[model samples]
Target: MSTRVLVQQLQSLPDGPVTVSGWVETVRDQKKVQFVILRDETGAVQLVNPATRPPAEPVDPSTGSRTAEPQDAAADPAERAKRDEALALTDTISTLTTGTFLTVTGQLKHDERVKLGGVEIKVASLDVAAAALPETPIAADSAMDKRMDWRFLDLRQRRNNLIFRVQTTLEHAMRTWWIERDYIEIHSPKLMSSASESNAELFALEYFGEQTAYLAQSPQFFKQMAQSAGFGKIFEIGDVYRADPSFTSRHATEFTSVDAEISWIDSHEDVARMQEELLSFAIGAVAAKHGAEIEELFGVAVSAPTVPFPRIPLAEARDIVAARGYDIPRTDGDLDPEGERQISAHVKETYGHEFVFITDYPHEIRAFYHMRDDETGLTKSYDLLYNGVEITTGAQREHRVDILMEQAKQKGLDPEHLQFYFDFFRYGVPPHGGFGMGLARVLMLMLGESSIREVTYLFRGPTRLAP
Candidate 1:
């Protein structure tokens, strides 16, 4: 038996007999012919079976034969082989069900009429394989929650298919950019000895017998430790858990964080430039490789943003939104979700761009470690916005032990509680700053996907805990 060739593998094969296998995406049942749209991760293709009505076998009215009459033995193998292949296909279609898994060996035909990539396979034989229950749990038109309940079915859509491809392309571009710049890529421990920044969002669980352990919320302090330890510039793309339960499209209890920090940077502006370059490479890669597919699937055109994405001072952004008739409905010196939307809309209309950075956030809302600007009483901080969603929060951090301690105290946070994290500053460290961006949210916004779950491989949310 030949190995199971994936649908994607068909593209490289010479036009000849080949075997392909995958779950049936569509079943076009016809009296004189049948077709199955089969899909695997790489691509989708059409499987053609020139078979008479299957199962309740069709009668050959002229000959009154229930079975297909045998092709003449003296006929040429090419024509006879085609006849025999079609007959075998007829029988194979007799037992197929919508979600059945199967392997097929057949002649690959490059035909323009077949809509699936303008290709088709004439079946010689196929294994009926595992058939699914007739009543599908969820249909394409099903509601989001119901479709999520049957996620495997929901992922079959081509739009969902292109999302991850774009993700892979983006990640690759980032990795290449990091490698070329000689930045160390590190994977910090998910289970930590102490909180990286604070206990507010940590997932604490009992440790071996006596003490307790916690899941790291961000690689903040540890990445800083590496800065102290003199790795110079380092980055990590890893998962972090949060205990907060704010149910929003952008909030996830657990999520992949894209983090990076560099020593000897002048300020957060330095960090902001690196971030702009990183995302620029990512969006550019996606535009070059998957832009057309993204348009076909998502109904939106994408472009790799040029360097220096629009930057707006928080105060100026406030004035812009306020002038535009939308007051930020909060007192935190920050924009609310609606305000974010309004500001983003203004950026698009004013600058013709999809991303913007709102910078110099007020010190009060930032973490205790964020470096405070004496001139303005604000932190050297920024949030990168895509379409109107906050995807990253970054700032220059206080490296002075005494000032860091004072800031922690002023925040009503306990010094005794954050002893471990504070120690990074106690030891000698370079002036450094970086950003933590949400992985799925970036992909979600980049592809214009409506929900985080749509782009997440296996979404984890307040209610979703299982496959």
Candidate 2:
């Protein structure tokens, strides 16, 4: 009747009667004793029950002879009741399948011999909450596709559960760090009248008759609008939609974006400094909170990156990769995946850092809103690559409407279509800059995961969308 005791909490508590509820992980039905491993979100624990046989006929206390049996005989009521209850519990536990939900009220005992946490519960009563199907469609070694098909089952693994926990800790830490610094949290609208970034990969939907609306590719426009609105500093952690058809390990059609915009920034270097400090604080929180569990489950030590992540110019990065014998085959003056990897390798070897900010990207590859350097003609932009994967794109924004419009025209983008965005600049807007970071991509790189799909709760791609 009392609140259920969590499996993880049992270790620190004194041994006594307690009730625990969770799904059955494994059942070992034996002739003498039955054992069931019950698992909740916290952890797993062992439950034991001794077998009981049918009771013998009861003797009448007064006559010293066998009592006459009725349809619902209660002869030797106390003994019969105890025996029947044990039989029911033994049978119930034996019938339990993996993933069955149940509650156990029992005497909690700490036994050193028990392999699982050195503790066990002796069941006094068992209540079956829900019975799962006997045969599971997936297994420990199931193929990734099949595992994804049954993600509900796949997530039942403790390691998968730990992934979301670590993610929660990481996000919370970042929010706390930002809030303490007077950053306003904003929830930018996902539905938009126009694209915020490039128009190449917009998800268009028909609004009222003949009117088309598109999912906002990023919070770029509104985030910058926050700067114009004089909010000073703002942060948004929200979902963004993309129609990118690339079937790469790092590509997802929909993903969580971590964005931040600040007013009165000197240049893109200031933005890069804030981002590196943010990552150091956030990743350090993750490592401190879940380091042991991650190492146990993932076999990879969580690295809390130091501040001042190495910065390299995009042009220099390309040359470094080229010098490393890997020429980027792109004409846009951007580093390809292999090139990013080479630069990351060089950074690891030279600076001993896992994160590198590739700065001063060419205007041809960056968004039109990015501020162009007066002398260099390159955009004051940067891409933060984590372990060879690009996790973020950041830049200083051009506040002058005239230059922004001209840049838009130069990029072959219609200035009229972005008039609403330009309006933010037309007003008295301070110099500002921001970044859009992929949350799953960060987790993928931190955990050494091969794909973003592994960290995404429900991956969306060009072809796959369902339960």
Candidate 3:
């Protein structure tokens, strides 16, 4: 009745009996011996078993010649039981398939030659918990869509497991940093009577009666409401839905949004400084905890970014890109994918940093609630870019009730329909700002993954809905 131990714990224990449970990763049923590569949540280990063959034909002692059949009538009872058990164990190992869940009781041994954590287990018995099918649905060389189809099985890969572990560390570190600074955590309602941002990219559905409800695009309005409610600072990690149909690598129908709102900010610069410091601290925690494994699995070195990440205004960033021989094709006063890449490359070359904040976007391309500078007329907002991709957008919001209503009207949104939102500002709220960041996008960039799908646990794209 040995308790189950994780593969990672084996390295620290002295050689003795131990039980390990995990799904079978690989099995090699050799003629003389069997080898199984068992993987648990923590790590993978080697399981060894000596193959027990059937007894040889009975030799006739009188003539010293082999007989046609073996006799069991005179066999020792105890010896017969041991031989039968051994044969059965060997057969079970031979039939074991990949991805089968099982528990093994064995003698844990440390061996310098063993590659997997320099440890091996001599299995005495195996208890099958669940047997997997003989054939696998996906392969190592499978396409991204195919792999995503069987995501549960696909996540069995060691690299995929580490991706989530890194994510956990990153989030915990960020939460710790916020909580230490007296930040409140909030969970905003997902079903809202009105859109959080705009009419576009909203998933609307029928409510209890004739009224309709929409899935929140972000926790923008609620986060602001908290600010009005006298919550000085708050953070939320929750799911937000978008009706965007784009099949881009970064777009998702539903995603976890990491949001933070703080009251009494002078401008977007305050928000930017806070976000940069938050990222630097979180990334440093990840580098400290799982840096080696990340580098080994993802082939990307994880490092904490320095504070005061390079900042370039939207117009200046475009000019920098143009200087590098790339023109932003979009006419919306926002950087296209190519423009972002070019600007990011410039930042990396000039400042030696992977993160850059493209700030002071034209009001035409920004949300109406974003505060407008009296001097420049541009919105005091910024898009945080990491490794050539935009991961977050933050801004100083207009808290004045009159100004807020006017801005809403300018964007073609009816003030009557947004009265509930405006009520927060009418009650005398402080000037506030915050940011909503895509969690998957941050993880994807950190791990050097090409798509957010690799980091998202269950990605919801326009065309993908099932498990």
Candidate 4:
């Protein structure tokens, strides 16, 4: 018979036979009917069975999807003992562990009392796909690190569930926006011979034996390389690695980076327009697809930011935030985490918007490639702030090779090592600009999630190395 999903079986007739496959969420057995809440990747459906076994049914070995597997009730003495042990193992999973897998063939019953999905499957036949042990390694009340230990179970929560869905919707919208604009989507290699921005804090690895390679901290250089190669405009959403040991809710060892670059920009203003448009697209798409569910699960309202997100110079924002009595504690001109929060709050209070672009960062604070706005003595850079966290860093690049080399030297980097990168600006490179944002950071803050780990699937963090 063809495979069918449990959710599709909801409208099935009560007497009609149906098949359901999913991890066992819970099993409630009384005197007559036994019930198991089955969950798959999509959602949950309940499967009900009779407490008393019916006539003999053949065990299907194909769908070992359950955490519990049946044993030979009749066998030789030695084999039966092993079988008994297997049955005991399966029986142990009747306790509450949500990650156990099961596949149940059952009848359909639409019951009003059903707490999930408003329908239940009367399990006429069943199979144990896979069984998790009775005890789970992590608790819902566990710390973020602990929950990350059992991230598979940790993601089973409805709030964490909505986070990824919202991410999908937001990314889908961004892709659609880019495609509509005829923007070529690109994937840049994560290994580079030279630092795209700087060399420090790079995760380096051995290349053969003669040379060294570093994992990309961002797709910035390759995207700029595209601009040098005459790709008018481009965007990339991919993983970026950073070796910085930032112990914060927002920091991750590896992150999904959303990046873009374009040629012939009027200034960083052109880049800012695209940023606002793309962000608005993402927010609007998420709100349309899952707004009500987000409100139900995350308890936060999502809205597409209106065009022209409030843009204030970094110095202006610093002064404004300082006036509010929360001085940025950083010695550098860059905003700290607390400063980001306060500035976001300041923007919310002043412009009534959740997003703000703090532009014109001090040259010493921003990367060397950012163009210097001579009038202001600040780089043509901006940090896109969302809901009190910095989600993106963008700027108009220093296309002048001489100035770029000078900037690199001033930052204490060897200019000769960056020969190929500087060579891009030596010839026919356009006046270009772009931005790179962390995808999960945007989603986490958008859904009001406390950490990026909650949104990223199989997150790689400082101490998290395995599934």
For TM-score, the strongest prediction is 3
User: What is the per-residue lDDT of model 1 for residues 1-467, given as tens digits with 9 covering 90 to 100?
Assistant: 98777777777777888888888777887877788887777787888876643235558898988877554653888976666666666866765777777888889987777777767898777886788777788888898888888887888777777777888888889988988999999998888866666667778888997888899888888888898898999999889988877788888888889999988988899999999998888788889998888888788788978878899999999999999898677977789998898999999998988889999888788888899998988899999999999999988888999999999899888788788877787779999999999989988888787789778877777788878
Pick by TM-score: 1 or 4, better one: 1
* Regions more than 4 Å wrong, model 2: 53-75
- Which scores greater on TM-score, model 2 or model 3? 3
- Scored by lDDT, the top model is 3
Give each prediction's root-mean-square deviation over alpha carbons: 3.9, 4.4, 2.2, 8.2
Cα lDDT of model 3 by residue, 399-440, tens digit: 998988999999999888898999998878999999999999
Over 296-348, each residue of candidate 2 has an lDDT whose tens digit, in order, gives: 98888986898899999988998899999997898888898999999999999
Error of 4 at 160 (Å): 2.6
- Ten-residue segment with the worst summed lDDT in candidate 4? 87-96
- TM-score of predicted structure 3: 0.97
Error of 1 at 202 (Å): 2.9
Error of 1 at 343 (Å): 1.2
Deviation (Å) of 304 in candidate 3: 0.4
After TM-score superposition, what is the CA distance of residue 167 in candidate 3 from its true location, in Å?
Answer: 0.9
lDDT of 4 by residue, 1-467 (tens): 43766464455446456676777667675555556677776678877644543224455579734444555466589976655554443343345356677666656667788788677776545566676887778776898778877887888776777777777888889999998998999999998887767877688999998899999999888898999999999999899999878778888889899999999997898999999998888799888889998899888888888988999888888898898898788888778888888889988998899999999888898888999987977888899999999988899998998888999899998988889888888778999999999988888888888888778898886777787
Q: Can you give the TM-score per candidate against the true fold?
A: 0.91, 0.95, 0.97, 0.87
